[model samples]
Target: MEESQEEIKRGLKDVAACETRISHVDPKGQLYYAGYNTDVLVGRVSFAEAVYLTWFDNLPSQKELSDFESSIISEMNLPEAVIKRLKSYSNSNHPMDILQSEIPYLGMHDPDLGDNSDSANRKKAIRIVAKVPTIIANLNRIRNNEPLIPPDDKLDFASNFLYMFLGKYPDELERETINKYMYLHLDHGLAASTFVARSTVSTQSDIYSGITSALGSLKGKFHGGANERVRGMLNEIKNIEDIEAYIQGRLDVKKRIMGFGHRIYQADDPRTKHLRELCENLCRRANKLDLYEKSKEIEFVVLNKKNIRPNVDFYAATILDALGIPVTFSTAFFASGRVAGWIAHIIEELNQRIIMRPTSRYTGKYGREFISIDKR
Candidate 1:
C-alpha cells in the first residue's frame, strides 16, 4: 500500500517559529530579549534603549545610545509632502487609515529600501523605527487641526514625541508615564499584527510594505481597537454608581467586555501588571485615584463572575486618560509603540528570507469544464 503524502498542517500553533539567539518567553508568559527580562528592562532602561536591544540583541553603550537617539529624533519630522498627502484624506478617515496609506509611501522617499543587503536592510529598519513616531504624531495633529512641530534635539525620543504631539514638554511624571507605556508595548510574542509584518517581509518585500501590512492588521477591532473600546466603556459608566449595573447589563447581553482577556494570556497579561502599577501611581499623584478605584471595581466584578482579568488595554486607557490624551488618539498612541516591534519583526523576517506563503485545503471540485456562452 502506498503511504499518503505527509499532511502538513497550516497555522501550526504547536510549531516554533524560530530557533535562534534572539528573544524567548518564560513559562509564566513573560517576555525577554537577549537574556534580559522585559520587566527589569522596562524599569531600568529607556524606551529607545529597549527598542535597540530588541533589534540588535544587546543594550547599546552611552555613545551608541546617544547616536541612536539622535538618529531617531532627527527623523521625527515628517516631510512636508507626506503631511500634504495626509491632509488630502477626509476628516472622517480614521488615523489608522492614514497610517496604512503613509507607511507604504516611505518607500518612495527612502533610497535604502531599494537595497536588500543585510547592512542596508538594517539601516532601513532603523529608518522605519525612527520615522514611524513622526507619522503617527502627524496623523494625530492632522486629525486635531493642529500644526506639526519639528523634533527638538535636546529632548529624548519619547519626550520629543510627547512635546511634538502636544505642543509642550511633558512634566517629569508625565514623561515617565509615557515612557513606561512605550516600554510595555515594545513587543509581544508573535501577535497577529506582528505576524502580518513578518509574513509580508518574509516575501522579500521592503520594510514599508511589511509595516503597511501590519498596520492594516492592527487596525482591526480585535487587535488595536481595544484602547478605543475601553474609553467607550469608561464613558458609558459616567459615575461610580453606574459601574456595576453597566457591567452587569453588558454581561447579561452576552457582550464581551473590552480591555479584558487576551488571546495569549490565559490568567493575566504580563504587560498589565507593570502598566497598572504606573497608572496607579500617576492616578494617586493626580488625586484621580477614584478613576483607578472604579477600574479596580470593574476588574473585581469581571474576575469574580467571568474569570477575566484586565489586559494592557485596560490600564493603558487609564494612563492615557491621566496623561490628558484625547480618547480619539488613544489607539494612535498604541500604534506609536507597536511600530518599533513591527520594524524589528520585519528585519528578522528579511534576514531569514523565507517566503511566508501558506496553502489552503482545496474545497472545490477539481475537474469541471466551462460551458460556452452560446450554450448558456
Candidate 2:
C-alpha cells in the first residue's frame, strides 16, 4: 500500500515504539518510573535504590539496598586488561568513543556472556551501570594527562565520581547535588539511546553490545551530546551583557538553540527545577554565582522572544560547570546516569521478545537502465 505524506513520521516524534513498564513521560511533562513519580524519588531514595527500582519494578528494602550497593561497588573496578587498554587510549580518542568501545569489550570478561536468560542479563545490566562511571572518569583523567584516581569503595557512587574528578571527596552538599543529577537523569521514557539499546538487544545480542549501540546513539549532537552544546552556549555568552546579543544573533540566523526546547516536554521540563536550584546552590558555593545569574537572564530573553523555556541540560550545564567538569566531558557525565535507563529498556525489550525493526518509505526510483562497461 502506498502511504500518504501525512502518515510519515520524520523522526518518530510522538510515536509509540513499544509497550514498556520501565518509565512513562506524561503529556504534562512529569516523568514516572515503574509507577513512581521521579519527582518523589529523588530525595526519598538513594540513586542505587532508584536504579534498582527501575530494573526490578519495585523499591528495595534494607537488606536488598545493602546487597545492591555492595554488588554495584564490587563491579566498579575494571578488568586489568581493560584498564591497560584504557591507559593506551589516553592520547586521542573522545571520551564517548573510548567509553562506547570499552563497554562492549567488557562482555568478553563476563561469565554469562553467552547466556540470554533473564537472570544472567540482570547481572550484566548491573555491571554496565556501575562500571560506566569509572570508565568515563578514567578516560577523562588520562585525556587530561592527570594521574588516575582509584575508586573509593567507602563513598557512594556520585561522591566517588566526585573524588575521581576533583581528586577529593566533595562536601556533603556537592555530593547530594551530584546524586540528584544522577537520579533525575536515571530514566525518562524510551529516549533515543534507550531505543538504540533495546533494538540491539532485540536480536538477542549480549547486553554489552547493546550498550555500545546506545552509547553511539547518544554521541550524536541531538541526543546526550546536547548538554555539551549547552555548555558551549553558556561559554559563548560569558557575560550577562552578551546574552541578549548572543540569543538575538542565533535567532536572526534561525539557528536552533540546543537546550531551549524538548520533543516531549510541553511547557517546561519538570526535571529542570531541582537542577536549577542545585545549579544555583553549587555556583554560589563556588562563588561563581554569575553563571547561574547569566543563565537566568538567557532564560528570560529566550522565553520572551522565542517562547521556549530551558530543558534539563540548560541548568545541568551550569551545575556540571560549577562542579569543575569541562564541556568535553559533560556528555560522558550524562551517560553515567543514562546507562541505567539503557539497561532498563534493554532488559524490558528482551523480556517482551519483539525486535524493534521499523519500516521506512522508499522514495527512490524503482527502475533504472543498466549499462555495460563499454556502453559509454
Candidate 3:
C-alpha cells in the first residue's frame, strides 16, 4: 500500500486564506482599492483620503475628510514619556528597530489600550497613522543631533511628514510626489508584512502588537527593505558605463537582483508607471537626472536579459534619493505609509474571529522510537 501524504504549498503561494473587500491584487497587474481602480485614485485623492477609504470602505465627503484630517493631525504629538524613551536610544540604532521598540510604549500612552471595540480600534488606527511619521522623522533628527521638529497642523498628512523630515515646507512638486508615492503603497494583497499583521491580530491581540510584528517582517531585505537595497545597488554602479557590466556580473553568480522582479505581477507592476514618472520629474528637479537615466538603463538591461520587469521598489528608491533621503531611512518611510494598510488588515482579521493556525507537512521520520536514557 502506498503511504498517504499531503501536498505542501511553500510560502502559501496561491493559497487563498481569507476573503477581503479592502483591496484586490489582480494577477494581471491591476490593483483596486475597495473596487475603485488605483489609476483613478492615485491623483484624485490624498493619502489621508485613501486611508479613510480603506478603513471605511468608501471615500469621504468634504466635511468628513476635513474632520478625519483634523483627527489624525490632533494625535500627531507624541507623549512626553515616549519622546523621552526615543531620545534614550542610540543614534546608531536602525530606525525600524526604534519604531518597533517604541510602538508598545505608544500603546502604553493610548487612552483606549486593551479595548478592541470598533470605535476604539478606529481611534487607535488614527494614532498609528499619525505618529508613525513623527517617530521616523524625530529619530532621524535625533541621530543628526538636530532638535525635533513639531508637526505643522496647517499642512496635510504627506506634506507635514516632509516638512518635519526636512525642516521646511515642501514645494508643490515634492508634496505631490509623496502623496502619489504613499497612496500607491497604501495596500496590496496579502504581502509578507500584511500577512504577519493579520496573523498577529488573529490571536485577538491589540493593534500595537500586530503593527510591531509587521514592522519586524518589513525590515527584511526581500520585503520593505528592498527599496533600501535598490538604492545601494544604484550607488554601486559608478556611472552609466558601469550598468550592463554590473547587472551581468550579479546575474553570472546567480545573485538575485534587488528590485527587478516581484512574487506577484508578471507584467509591469501597476504602481511602477506612476513612480517612474515621479522619479523622472523629481530627479530632474533635484538635478539628479543622471540618476534617472542610469535607472532606466538598468531597467532595460534587466528586462532584456532576464525578461523581468522592475517592481515598485526599483523606482521608489530613486524617488527617495532625489528627495535627499539617506538610503538607511528608506524602509522607515515605507513603514510609515504602510501602517495604514496594516491597521486596516488588523481590523479585518479581528472581524473574522478565527485564529490563523495552518498545518505543516512533516517530512522527518515520524515512527522513530525514543530509547530510554538508561538503555543508552
Candidate 1, 178-201: lDDT as tens digits: 787998877776777888888887
Candidate 1 TM-score, C-alpha based: 0.92
Candidate 3 vs. truth: CA RMSD? 1.6
Rank list by TM-score = 3, 2, 1
Q: All candidates' TM-scores?
A: 0.92, 0.95, 0.97
lDDT of 2 by residue, 1-376 (tens): 4543446787898788889898998868788989998888877787888898988899999999889988887888888888888889745568888888888688898888899899998888878887899887777777777988887778887778778877777788888988899988888887888888889988877788888998899878778788899888988887899888889999999997777888888867889888999988899999999989998998899999999988877888889999998778888888999899888888888888777777766765645788898995
What global local distance difference test value does model 2 have?
A: 0.85
Better of 1 and 2 by TM-score: 2
**Ten-residue segment with the worst summed lDDT in candidate 2?**
1-10
Residues 285-319, candidate 3: write the lDDT tens digits.
98899999999999999999899998888999999
Question: Which residue runs does candidate 2 get wrong by more than 4 Å?
Answer: 1-6, 90-92
- Candidates' C-alpha lDDT: 0.79, 0.85, 0.90
Which ranges of candidate 1 are over 4 A from the true structure? 1-12, 20-22, 25-27, 374-376
Which consecutive 10 residues in model 1 have the weakest lDDT in total? 18-27
Q: Which candidate is the best by TM-score?
A: 3
